[model samples]
Target: MRCLWDCWPMRLTIKSGIAALLLSTGLFGAASAAPAQVADMPPAGEGPRGTSQAVLGAERYDAIGYAVPYDGGANPGAISAAHPTLPIGSFAEVTAIDSGKTILVVIAEQGLATPDRIIALSPGALQLLGRPEAAALGVRVRRVNPLGADQQALRDGRPASARIDAPAVLLAALRKRLPAPPRSVSTAMPRPPRASNAAVNLGAGAGYPVPGRAAAPSVRPATSRQGTGFFVQVAALSNGQRASDLANSLAGSVMAGGGLYRVRLGPFPDQASADRARADAVQRGFGDARIIHE
Candidate 1:
């Protein structure tokens, strides 16, 4: 037979046999059993020992930067706002960045400001901030007081409570000095039966007399308190007689103060109820009837 090294096939077969023998003897097993290469690893740093625990961007937050008007009209001139996160009855301090004018505002309603805005202020706050056109910008806000659990609980489904309560508290302090509600005001007016066309007898070339609707009783205007709770100021007047006449016509209630009589209907259970009363008062010819807070 040809020599193993001289014959190509025999030479290759002898080499493979020797390699298998070495592997079975465990001579090169250490190399074969070594850990995988970087290419075969999980990732650059994916193992249990490789991960980092530090959080990224933990301090990122949106700061209050501007103010919009709280347009609910319940407490027009009150220092109040609709906040995105603050619970009702919570109080916040607002500072105008440019003017450095700071004021306290109560959380009255839940709302998110525009991405570029922060809180919505009441007319009074807006005016105090010197932003009377319904909106202000470039302001800073900080929480001054958090709502207590009990009051926040009471204001859970009732957002108006905060707006109403602030003014109510102030009103309570001044109640003893305030004038009492007017009594015995008659809002009654004569209501004639509608004249039927048939009763008038339609005749050719004959003009029939048409009676106009009765005029609404006149009343004085009064300024409303800036608080929450539902009421409609149908009329306000310094003239007691006119105020009494209007109150009597509407058959509602009256409050007199500061030489002015206010024909009002309240304290309704909710804003919707008060709004409906406002509409009815307006329809009844109190042209300036509007929703107001007690």
Candidate 2:
């Protein structure tokens, strides 16, 4: 998911120091807000803006290198990418020639220098790319102006045809399956539900009455902290042979998750350690070993 910052300029002045500290610690600002009702949000594959056309090329560098860290969640909808030099938030299109599939992913974070690759695919994106197995798959990258009608559709919550070909059909199905949008809580005149006197006593007590006796203590919800480490994402595959070939090449360094075989280097405690692992992976022929948060 994208990090949605409050546009209030005054808040920046009030908390510049705090913001800097949070950034240094890898905790993103604005993520502290209660989680949004993302259920209504479209799936990651719901549009073409998320899809791009990339031209495949030979691995550019012999060794992989790490890029700077990104603070956003591992959400495919956000237009972020890991590039050798492109500023954060820059937009690009990636196309897989083998399968004729394309996706537009933004530079959300920095990426490895080796495999001398274009963009790293998000987990959702990797699935869309057909899951190639080679240590590195060919990809092409080009800058795109992110202000077209397609982009607008994404920003405005309209379904993009590139991602959701049958929006109406899908929406209809979802409406049938999901409950209506929840009503907001009213602050005034709150009233308790109608219940018997015994039931009301149970509600007022520390533990509610169960059929047998007291109810168990309520457990707090789990805290949702972001992953601390990073992994490389290989998106797009032409065919099973390509996927198998890539998988075999990086068999030692790769692990499968969410259906994609991710090539990772470290649970490094710091960026320096991660960088070293990335460099070593590139030297060992895993040219596109990018550091991604786990």
Candidate 3:
């Protein structure tokens, strides 16, 4: 009877061992079927990192004054412009200082080809910024939304040099002191002055061309310089032929300047005279006509 009781204890011990073994096997299988606990957890450093967080923030430059009459091919109305260094087709937001208005524009062609200006916005973009027909304005520009690659490039890249800002009051004052540029003259030779009796003259019948009329009075150089007179700019074109054509069509003189060939009415003596010419230009379909100084 003692031996049977001992065997019963052994049998119980065997059963317990088997149950524990089966439980361990089931746990091992589950562990093998599923990923490790740490593997299931979020990636390392993910707790502090987020999609909104940037490894390096975007760079911003200080104020730059942009010039007007931007030219970007056939689509003059497009809210686009050109920059000297910014990648073409990239997007940027420009904020006007005085009006506090902002505009989104795409970099289109090459800029004004000058270091004096940063980005040149199209007329449409300028109008959207709430300042239409402004010759120049102080503005801040920065990349707003960019492509993934562009963002990466920008983050890794160095910021561009800030453009030199022109002082408003100083520039205005200097402009007031500037002298008007001389008008363009045709290549046609001026009529020779009539020879006086005291001057040596070729004998007549030498096929020499005689003066058609009285000699023109000589223009003496002014002792004191005059200020630059006002002018009305009708059009600014890049194509020399097109500009010449427009100038020929217009009644006034043409001036080539500001990166694009310009068609202007006159170097009128005063703003009042320029206003009258501008009115005439507006009547002839030049709606963007504006007064200009040399």
Candidate with more favorable, higher lDDT: 1 or 2: 1
Model 2 compared with the native: what TM-score?
0.29
Top TM-score prediction, candidate number: 3
Per-residue accuracy of model 2 over 1-294 as CA lDDT, tens digit each? 443466566567659978788888877665775576745434533323344322233222211211111212345444334555444444555544334355555554443333333345444444545542222334434455444664554333232235312244433433343332212212231212222111000011121011101122222232232135654433212122333345445442333222122333335677777677677776776554566655
Best by lDDT: 3
Candidate 1 stretches with Cα past 4 Å from truth are: 1-62, 146-294
As a whole number from 0 to 100, the lDDT of residue 85 in candidate 1 is: 60
Question: How much lDDT does each candidate structure score?
Answer: 0.47, 0.38, 0.48
Off by over 4 Å in 3: 1-63, 113-115, 146-294
In candidate 3, position 169 carries an lDDT of: 45
In the range 206-289, model 3's lDDT, one tens digit per residue, is 110111112222222322222367878776443445544566577554343223345566668888998999899889887767
Error of 3 at 169 (Å): 21
RMSD of each: 24.4, 29.9, 23.7
Backbone clash total for model 1 is: 10
Off by over 4 Å in 2: 1-73, 76-80, 132-135, 152-294
Worst 10 residues of 2 by lDDT: 196-205
Candidate 3 C-alpha error for residue 246, in Å:
29
